[model samples]
Target: MAEQALANLHTDSGMHGRKAERFAVNRASRILSINPALSGISIRSCHLLDISRVGATISLVTTIGLSDHYYLNIMGTANRIGCAEIYRNGSRVGVKFIKEIDDELLHTIVRGDFFTAAI
Candidate 1:
C-alpha cells in the first residue's frame, strides 16, 4: 500500500542485490506498560504469538482496536519507543514494531534468560 525503499545499498557485488534478514521470536507476552505521550491507551496482558522487527502478533483476552499510532514501552526498554495498531483475528491482536528493543534486555530475551526481575 505504500512505496518503500526497503533498505540501504551496500554497493558490493555480494551485498548489492540483497536485503537484510529479520529475526522473529514468538512467545506468550503480558502487557508491561505504555508510553505516556500516546493516546488510545488501551492494552492488557495477552498471549504474544509472534514477534519480528516489524511488529508482533498477539491474542488479547479483550478487544483493543487498531491504528498506526501510539508509543509502547515494550519490556521496559527506555529507548524503545513505537506504535502498535491492534488487529483482531478471532481473539488475536496484531501489532507492528515501531522501535528497536534495547541491547541488554534484547540480549537477555533472545537468550531465553529469565530471572525474578523486580518490576
Candidate 2:
C-alpha cells in the first residue's frame, strides 16, 4: 500500500496542456520498488500532486529515467493505478492511466479519502 491522495502536490492550478481538470490531492504514497520490469531501481517515495479520471500529477525528488510504466499502488487496499508517463517537469510528472478511474473513486478522493477499492 503506497499511494497518497492527490491534494498535496502543491498545484492549485491545473496541469498545463491537459484537457482534463486535475484536482490537488495532498497525501502520501510509495513507488513500487521491486518490480522485475523495473530492475536496478528501488522504491521511491512521492506525493500525489493532483488527479483526474484519466491521469494524475505526482511529485518526486527525481523522476529521471523512471520507467514509462508504473503501478501506482494504493496505500490501504490491494488497488493499484496503472499509468504511463505523459510529461515531466523537474521533480513533477504527469501520467495517463492505462485504465480510467470511475466516478465512485473520484468522489472518494475529492471527499478527502484514498481509493480503497480497485477501479
Candidate 3:
C-alpha cells in the first residue's frame, strides 16, 4: 500500500526517470513560488531530505503541484537559491538548482550546519 501511494505521487508529478548523485540530509526549508497572474508569491513549508551541488530532494508538508521553477529558502540563512523540479514521489520531490551554489555554502549545507546562523 505504501509503495502504491508513492508510485501514484511519482506519476502524478511526472517524475519517472532521473540520473544524479544525491547526498543524504534532513533540514527544514521554505518553498517559494511566484504567480505572474496574481503578481504574488506563495510559500510552502517542506523538509529537505538530501542535497547535492546540482539538486536536492524535498518532501512537502502537503501535496501541491509545484511550479517548474521555484526558490528554496534554506532555514537559518538569508540566501535563496533558484531551483527547478526534477522528480517526485508522494510528498517527496527532487529539484535541481538553477545555478550552482558556491563550494563554501555547499559545504555548510552538507555539514548539517544549516540551522546555524553563523554562515
Worst 10 residues of 2 by lDDT: 5-14
Q: Judging by lDDT, tell me the better candidate of 1 and 3.
A: 3
Off by over 4 Å in 2: 1-21, 33-42, 113-119
How many steric clashes between backbone atoms does each model show? Answer: 2, 10, 0
Residue-level lDDT of model 1, residues 20-63, one tens digit each, is 22233333455544345654355555654444444555666666
Q: What TM-score against the true fold does each predicted structure earn?
A: 0.46, 0.67, 0.72
For each of the candidates, the C-alpha root-mean-square deviation to the true structure, in angstroms, is 10.4, 7.4, 8.5
Q: Which pairs of residues have clashing backbones in candidate 3?
A: none
Per-residue lDDT of model 2, residues 6-102, tens digit only? 3333322234644554566655666664457545555777877678778777888888658788777545435678888888988988888788788
Worst 10 residues of 3 by lDDT: 4-13
In Å, residue 83's CA in model 3 sits off its true spot by 0.7
Q: On a 0 to 1 TM-score scale, where does candidate 3 land against the true structure?
A: 0.72
What is candidate 3's lDDT per residue for 1-46, written digit by digit as tens?
Answer: 2232122122122234543334565667999999879799989998
RMSD of 3: 8.5
C-alpha lDDT of all candidate models, in order: 0.45, 0.66, 0.70
* lDDT comparing candidate 3 with the true structure: 0.70
| Candidates ranked, most accurate by lDDT first | 3, 2, 1
Which candidate has the highest TM-score of all? 3
